[model samples]
Structures are given as C-alpha cells and as structure tokens.
Target: MDKSPDAYWKATLRLIGTVLVIWFAVSYLAGIVFAPALNSIHLGGYPLGFWFAQQGSIYVFVALIFWYAKKMDDIDREFDVHED
Candidate 1:
C-alpha cells in the first residue's frame, strides 16, 4: 500500500519525537534526576548513575543515532520514498 506525503511526514515526525524523548530520558532523567537512586547500583566498580552521566548517555546517544537512521530507512522504504 502507498502512503501520502502528508502521512509520510507525520510518521517521520513521530519517529523523531519518540527518539528525542528517549534521548532526553536517558541523558537527563537517568543521568541527573535519578542519579542518586541509580548510584545505589554498581557497575564495574563505579556508581551506575555516574556511569550513565559520564559515559552511558553518550553511548546511548550514538546507538540512538544508528537506530534512528535504520528506523528512518525502514520508514522511507515503507513510504516508497527511499533513496537509490
């Protein structure tokens, strides 16, 4: 089935929004707001929260970038808008 341009755009925007929200939650909420609680857990001799703040968020961000790209590629294919 084919989707209209408007529908394709809306789907793209929704995907972007969802990815941003996940990024924010990991970067802000986990790294800062819930850091204290997360600190109670240990990861490789360092506090889990500290790890999230110092490295995990960056890792998640990079992973998210790849994930987003792959998802968008799939979306483009679904919408019949993929590049050659």
Candidate 2:
C-alpha cells in the first residue's frame, strides 16, 4: 500500500524524536546523573561515565543513524514509496 506524504513525514519525525530522546538520555543524563556510580566501572582506560560521555554515546549515535536509515528504508519499501 502506498502511504500518504503526511504519513511518511510523521513517521520520520517520530523516528528522529525517539532517537534524540535516547541520545540525550545516554549522553547527558547517564554521564552526569549517574557518574559517581558509573565511575566504579572502567572501560577502555576510562570510567563508565567518561566512556559514555565521550566514546559510547558517539558510537551509539552513529549506530542509531545507520539503524534509522535501514529501518526507514524498509519502511519505505513496505509503503512502496522508496526512491531508487
């Protein structure tokens, strides 16, 4: 079935919002709010909080982008709206 433009836009916006929420939660909240507790654990020469603040969140964001692209690609195919 072909989806309306509005449906596609809404789905895209929702996907963006969801990823942003998780991005902020892990990068800022987890790195700061739970820092003390997380500091007890070490990861790759850094504390967990430091890892999340620096590398982990960045990695997760990159992964999220690729995941979102793949997911939307599938969605577009499902809606028979994918561009070549």
Off by over 4 Å in 1: none
lDDT per residue for candidate 2 within 1-84, as digits (tens), equals 448888778887888888889888888887788877898999887899888887788889899989999988987876778899
Models 1 onward score TM values of 0.95, 0.79
Cα lDDT tens digits, model 1, 16-74, are 99998999899999999999999999999999999999999999999999999999999
Q: What is the lDDT of residue 78 in candidate 1?
A: 95
Query: Candidate 2, which segments miss by more than 4 Å at Cα?
Result: none
Clashes of each: 0, 0
lDDT of 1 at 36: 99
In model 1, the Cα lDDT at residue 84 comes to 88
TM-score of 1: 0.95
Tell me model 2's lDDT, rounded to 2 decimals. Answer: 0.84
Clashing pairs in 1: none
- List the lowest-lDDT window of 10 residues for candidate 2: 1-10
